[model samples]
Target: MGKCIICGKPVDGLICEFHEEDVVFEFEGTSPSQLTPGRYYRGTVDGYADFGVFVDVGDHVTGLLHRSELDRRLESLDWEPGDTVYVQVLDVRDNGNVDLGWSIRQADREFRGSLIDAPDGEYRPGERDAEDESSSADDDSTTADAGPSTNGGDATPDEPAEPAEPAATPTMEIEEPDAPLKRTTVDALDDQVGSIVRLEGEITGVRQTGGPTVFELRDETGTVECAAFEEAGVRAYPSVEVEDVVALEGEVERRYGDLQVETETLEVLADDERETVATRLEEAIEQQARPETVEPLADDEAVAALENELVDAATTIRKAVVEARPVVVRHSATADGYVAGAAIERAVLPLVRDQHTRDDAEYHYFERRPLEGTVYDMDAATGDVTSMLEARDRHGEQLPLVVLVDAGSTVESTDGYDLLEVYDVDRLVIDDSHADEAVVDAVSVAVNPTLAEANGGAVTSTALAANVAAHVNEAVRDDLEHLPAVSYWEEPPAAYVDLATEAGYDETAVTEQREAVALEAYYQSYKDKRELVADLLFGDERDLAAHVSEQFRDKLEAELETARENLETTSIDGVTVATLDTAAFTHRFDFPSANLLLDELHRRERDDGPFVTLGLGEDELHVRTTTPVDVRELGETVADAVPDAGVRVVGGRDGHVEFLVGERDSVREAALDALAETLA
Candidate 1:
């Protein structure tokens, strides 16, 4: 019975995930190539899930090797998790999750072994040496854990090592045991139960369930379920990311015949060495990154360009937990042909939620809401649906594919997803070689940019929020004085109103205007916005025409682009214009009700240059842009246009709008900067 020479856990119960693989033999079509289903092939276990191990048997295809199919001796195999091992595909679900199975009992003479076998004899004959006792004693601590931090068991435990460089600080701290601390590595918690030990890794699950907050903790050693009793001093859990290394302070709590560590404290780990470099690099990169080229953006591209900026400008809460805002949602998956008996392209699931809201709801006023969705592929790219590992070989990248996903987000019992867009997928994975960022730079060949490209080379808001949360964690850990430094603060908009009138106009207005109906205009704008979003974020050609009619699609496309471009930056003196252009042509553009006359004067500074226009005129309001930047007189001047309508002029010392309108205006004007105090 072979065991994981490190953790001493039964391979049968342990899971394997496919991160690296080699295409031993080329398949026929560049498309779905079929081979004997039952054949055994060598590959690497990327990682594990509750369902099974994903084995990368080359061919850019991975197989799901389920735990049930593996023999009891699976507990003893010394194969490196990412290092290659023989695997047999059991089943590949349609939902993109894969399962694999391995058993020494079922394997040929090459793999046959007993669980009692140690790492020295079967797995690596060369690793065993007479003088290797020192290496064994020091390295055994790592055996209990195998993950991104593992480097072929070569870690020198006797020395305090220097941290390397990643774009972010990747260090995590481990709170030592209170007493005779079990110096066992995380992987070692697997077998022969003893006093629970402490290990640190990323927190994958932070779900409050079964009367306590339970989470899945992972490190190079392996993954284990962790539960908090509320007494562990963890008031609230941090939204740690999947790839991020977090410091987990807890003890082993075995339950249901399974061992899962229970955690109390979770602290952000800042690998100080890399923090300086990553922080500098991050700032440099942002300074260098430019918005996607625009100018001829069609209807969809129009809004997307703007939306892209909003996504970029949005306040990112590093390692923050925010839902995805899917203005236009679609579904797709990565599991195609390898293990599945047939190709299931037709099968699709709801990939995301629609970013819309009901009228008058508190959350309704907000354009972007929280998003909740599942990731079909862990290594999927930004613009493409294929996995990054797969993209590496196909595109011949200089670096191994690295996808940043908040894969660690968890809600209740639902599995969390990562909003990853491969801005830079580095290096090629050739026969499992050590590829780094430098190698990828050498290959520096560019492929079509993914979601980042489609959305003007920016990540989605969902991604931004997650990154922000991560940034927060890092800032705290790295003690980044520049970050977490508040430049401004205030309350949110309280007396805000929608731009369009909620009357839901009819088509009769279209006949009178000789143009498409306002409803058609709005719908077309919506469709175009969604389509542009699809193109920008997913690189999918989801068009606005799909949701709108041809009659208005051509007409409203340009306006939609304008509105999208001004996203996030549309705030005029802190008053967000919202989607005014789109609402102009929609069925119901909720009336701002904020004293229309004042708004007219507010917009006077628009394009007319030096006109001091005033009063609400025929089908339009007059604006006076050349007026002095004085507040009281502007309010009084604007008050004249209202007749009986309330006029309100806002802003501070610089100036404000003066018009005639309702109490909504004057009162709102007084409360001007109050609403935008926060981001102002």
Candidate 2:
């Protein structure tokens, strides 16, 4: 019988059945049948195949470590042929096939102790020599009892031999005290793997996984994950949370090619030590977050006019990343909005990856959400509050910095911005619309050309965002050169068109990309679709854009044909007014939404003369005009004409109004009359 290494209890082998999984085993047998299932073993990388890798267990046995069993991507594995690795033997088939699974620990010392699995039995490495010596001692005792004594005296059976002197009990020697543990920084942990280290830093994030509690620790140099476990699926150090200064001792380990710290002891720092770490982190973040300069992508006076505001906005975003705060971007569900949001996404993702140590920091630190319209209403604000609160309670995350791009600039968004203010969440707005003066005080930073007395009507939100994105990270400036042109449905400015042309995107390509993004935005309007959008705009896959654009063209043409066939035209006060009952003519729940179809139909019918297109839905009215129209003012006019109709504008700059379904005819007639007087 052997003893369990952990509990010190005698068992059938080196470990009890309950603790078998804790010990690692070495295979000494020559055949696959000698492998024990559900136990970890040391193996060598024999070779790799498309589906899995082949690991050699012993001299004559091999195991297949399938890709499905890997916790990470198979291609991410750095193991080469003949390199040592650790894997669990999941099964040994009747036909001599060995199946292996992934093991979290790769080092031998990570296990309690190793036992050799020989052809005959399992034993520790030096147990055989100890057993032989024990047998020899027993034989010597037997010989001495049966033969005459060494003193040369005959002893009778009744006579007892002289008692042997009791062997002296061994005394433990006291050694000198151990040296104090040296402090190591996160950046230097790579060179100290498999060794104990002490670190002092501030905890930026804390997450609970199935078996461990992972705390994201950030020092002056970088960030790293430190895992502590109290038990299976239980929280460790429940008092620790984000933004707390801590001193930790752990073994530096490599898990799935990423450096991790297996925490042994973690303590919160107080007084001077805590202040020291916090001050160091704050100083580093401040110095790294501020951009040295703010430069526009193109030579545009409109963009250059807002250079100071752009620098402030860029500084806020950069500082959020360095401070480990999430950036939540909210944009309108339109072509321009998507382009604006994607440009910022492209710039911020690289900064997130560079500032954090985890591979998934980009996803955690940056998020993009599409708003239904140009207004950030209370519904969106409520949803954002709920999600942010949940994240804070569950993961100990700090409140995110909400960024409004191409949206949330008018008075309609004031209530939403007010709700966010109650939580003290930071907000930044980058828009080109006629922003309400009150909005300037609601957000942290407002970057709008109207506030600077620039030509806001001619500037698209994409232009401002692309310029700000360039300032955020100058390295991605070339990647955003063509974005401004994609936001314009009509003829873009010559400066932007020339910029896109110089960036290898012709007019046709820009149009196709714009159409494609608009079509995708209508579906899953709330989702960001970060990867798909990135591929369509920045990836090398040109065919993907063409394919999606073709679908967009087909859908729009179909909707436009139906809309034109049912169109009604009238001239009031020398202004042409075209109307369509979109509820009866267009597909309500599919592609080519009422707004998009109306825009296309009006584009086809409008000439140099003043034209207005009204797409009447069940309870809403969408207006598209050749002349600038204030839907809010139009709503007030209609409300006066039809007092019972609940006339209110939903989308501010996009020109959307809502009324009672029963008063649709009254609202339509009143809206046309109001448009005629305004346009005349």
Candidate 3:
């Protein structure tokens, strides 16, 4: 018997079975199932497919390197049909199909040690006699007489053996009781740099880059990035996930002015150890996240009544940043929605930079997605879930915390919320819409005016988000104080107007930022345009905001002029009803979209005496009134008057109604008659 190289335990071979899988292995097996999962192997490119690439691990075993498992796209791969590549055997299916994963290390020498995977398990190259075979020819000129006895005693009868195993694995002793380790907190790591340190903490984040897999470990004191690598793009500790309480042993090293632990060994704590660590982390986080006193941004009774919910929303965002969870802010593609989303983005990005060591942590941890509509429908939630799942599975990223700003309030978003609920992804909705009461209870934190017993008409999403943003960080309150005023299209709230004026933003400047953000929100509706938006809202120079707002005014004014020229007015029951042929007059595809143009025209040219500006289009009839009109009531009126028009209240926030294009004339005539009778 020989001593196991790693644990120094007496065994049949030099290495034990427990540590055998830790080293890289060379494949000598013929069948695909014979190969071990989570082990790297040399492979040759067999061919490429539209979805993925096929690689031959050995002569008879071929595995598929799925495109989803790649760090880059399949088209970017430079490998030809015959090029050799290194891959990790992710799984060996029961049907003898091998699923291969990408490896950054192209050479075997980059790994710790080499072994051969056999039918039993894994072992050294020459350990199994049946697998190791060599022969000497006449031209080889081997000495018949033994010079130094090169063959070991384990050699076969017909063949000579190689030398005894060399010392490759480290010498370690396994005691009856585990050895006690000297542990230190993350805050004290700076003093232990370049020295071996053991840390007990929770894994806040796990990210697999092209090189090492970085685990953001957090203790009560602070957080540090621990990088563990078996091979590139391969999970170093596949069993360890985010939120796991682990005890990691490594040497603390500083890279690029940041402290990183070069992990040598990591173990997930269990039972007592896990409970102790988790309890300590929870206590610390609770104290840090909850402020002793939450000071409301404004002295309004309505805002004060929502103190608990606002604090909860801020705490959720702060905790998400501290834990390295990606924060996805989904908002409507409008001035108020973008402002609300940008307020949270401004607060969270600074916290993200402070919490994580990654330079692009803001981009990776926070995403502001401008939704096409004001509802978090299933389509939007499905897309978000798919992208986040891909990021988690392929890149080892933590599942994100979705922050619904000005969305996820109505009953229509319930299905979308349920989809995210299936993944157990934490969601927080900060809106001022007329939300279904069920939606308020469905989310982790819902901060809506309707839920707070406040009139939803007076509270805009930007106003609510700005209040929450102040409590999220409190440092960016001045930067975001002007945002609430920018969300108002008509008469501004006195409090928000005063707040903006105090923060050096006059009515014109607030209008400029509002119009600038609205115009920019249309382009790249998919992306948040972080830098451009930051410049427009929080930039030092007002010139950029002025320039963009000039474009906004130019386009909106041109559309308004066209609408005025095409205005078709009629007196019905002494009510001045103005109608605009939206299809022929407005620039359908250009800036100041249909809704914006109609809002502006209705704001500008509507006469008194219960004015109604009806924007008549092919498929939609958008209504704007000088007085508050219950949309559902008007929809019922129009539908009763014109049964074939199929008029429906499609938009709740703006009193928007829709009708069939085939019944446009009937719908318009009935709408005019309904307005005349109601006014009379």
Candidate 4:
């Protein structure tokens, strides 16, 4: 008999049956019945299909490799007809159909031994001389529990090692039983610095720096960084990736004030061992990291109904942090949007720091993106998918949890949410906007005032987000309590104002922070500007908020002064209607975006006898008024009066309406006439 390559146990051939499926074999059989189920075989690519690829395992036997069985995209495969490839026979149906699974090993040398299918339902060496009289049928399962061995014999009991050649799967080196070293948790590494330690964990992130490949590993207790230096910029352990369960041998060392492991050896665990470790880690995390019930931020009737969803949103975010998945926050580009997004960022960064040992964990784990408009569209979703998929492929990072704040409440966002659902990425929407009923179905969690039967007008995205943020990380409640006040453009909610006052932010400071964030939000629009935003909103140095606020006031005042000079007024059915040619009077490209300028202009004009500010641009008209105007009603009236205008209430909740300027003069005249008729 030949000995099993692993464990040095005597078997029928070079490898035992327990490791039969572990190695790639060349099948000489000609029929599906002759194929051994679960054994990987060298196959030839026969053809491709939309749903799968056909591979010829033998002259007459063919198997289907379904796209679902592929590790990556089917289109990514470079195989052509007749190309030699490797696939596993997952099953052979009684009808002579074979199902195939992708095999990671492509080279013949990666596995030990070659087995031939025998008509007697046994596996034997292709060369008869390789088998001896000592071989027996019971050898298959007899040595299944054996540790790794080599060609000559097993290594010395004191220093167990892997075979010189690559095995079907890399496994941990069997340590000497007498020289036992217990596995250490990451949280205990602080005390174990400068000492050799063994650790079992999953690789949460893998990054190749100039000198070392840094693997961010997380156990049930905590997370730590392990560095494996093979050569400068060269990838060490090409088979390992994020989410891989591993048994690592290393020395805990201090690097630049942080604890890191200098890896001596790292091994990816086998399937069964990996599952056991993963299940244990998951159970431990679930026990310790489960979110607790959050006390309501306020007992307002509007907030009461949403208490459950608020808790759920916070819970989802907390779970993502514990699971090492990045949280992506998408918000509108307005002051309200930025403040809401910033509040979530504030809550999440601290949790990331507490959970991870990496100093830059906050940046790596949390990101905030500002959207162009109130709708989450396909363009934005496509960009997010592209970037995140690249992160998955390059670093093996888990898919991110996409949180939409101040947006994603309408049917317009359905397509975007659908795209995300295809990848099974979790989504959360926190907004106070008027929502379509279908929106709740599109996201994992929908925390909206409208859905909870609360008055949407009584809520703002900042209020919803700030409350969720507070519950997400209670330590940042003091920092986030002032955010809602900064989001209001007109009447700040009394509750938010009272809360801000208690937090020590007076009226002026709130205004300054609001203006500063709005100004900064306009510049980048895309980037989160994590540090810059933190400084502007929460910093005391350089009077950053004060400085940006001053700039905001100057620009806004100058624009308002110029706008008032050019404003023309008329009485329309008892309502004093104000009109400004935004295309002519306003600096469309300068400080204070058209939306902000128009909001302020409308606010200022409303003091005089129920006024309305109609800022007419080249192809669009934005309507804002102090007089209570049913925007949807007025839009329908205008559309009826001026059929060519195509007017509609685009922002129903904000009392904002839009219409095409196709017939600009006609549209304006019709809008004025419609308002006059309504008021009359």
Top TM-score: which candidate number?
2
List TM-scores for all candidates, in order: 0.25, 0.76, 0.72, 0.68
lDDT of 3 at 187: 72
Output the worst ten-in-a-row residue range by lDDT, candidate 3.
Answer: 131-140
lDDT of 2 at 440: 93
**Alpha-carbon deviation at 135 in model 2, angstroms:** 19
Please estimate how well model 1 matches the true structure, expressed as its whole-model Cα lDDT: 0.31
lDDT, ranked from best to worst: 2, 4, 3, 1
lDDT of 1 by residue, 465-519 (tens): 2222222232221111111111001110111001001222112211211122222
Task: Write one digit per residue (lDDT tens) for candidate 4, span 321-426.
Answer: 8888889999999888989999999999988998887655676678888898888889989988986886676555788999999998887788999999999999
TM-score of 3: 0.72
lDDT of 2 by residue, 1-680 (tens): 87887788998767787777788888888878778899889887765543567777775577889888999977578875567889999998775678899999999999887888778877887887799999999999998878777335666657877766788999999999989788899889889999999998888888665456778888877788898988744789999989899999999987534588999999999999888888988898778777887667777888888989999999899888877888999998888899999999999999888777655568778999999888888999998998788667656678899999999888888899999999999989999877778889999999998788875248899999998898889889999999999999897888899999999999988998998899899889988988899999998977888899999999988888888889999999989989999999988999987887887888889978999988899999999899999888889889999999988876565558899999999999998889999999
Full-model lDDT, candidate 4: 0.80
Q: Please report, as a residue range, the 10-residue window in candidate 4 with the lowest summed lDDT.
A: 128-137
Give lDDT: candidate 4, residue 201: 88
TM-score, cand. 4 vs. native: 0.68
In order, candidate lDDTs are 0.31, 0.86, 0.79, 0.80
Which candidate do you rate higher for TM-score, 2 or 3? 2
Score residue 480 of candidate 3 by CA lDDT: 86
Off by over 4 Å in 3: 1-181, 188-191, 207-211, 231-234, 256-258, 455-457, 639-648, 653-655, 676-680
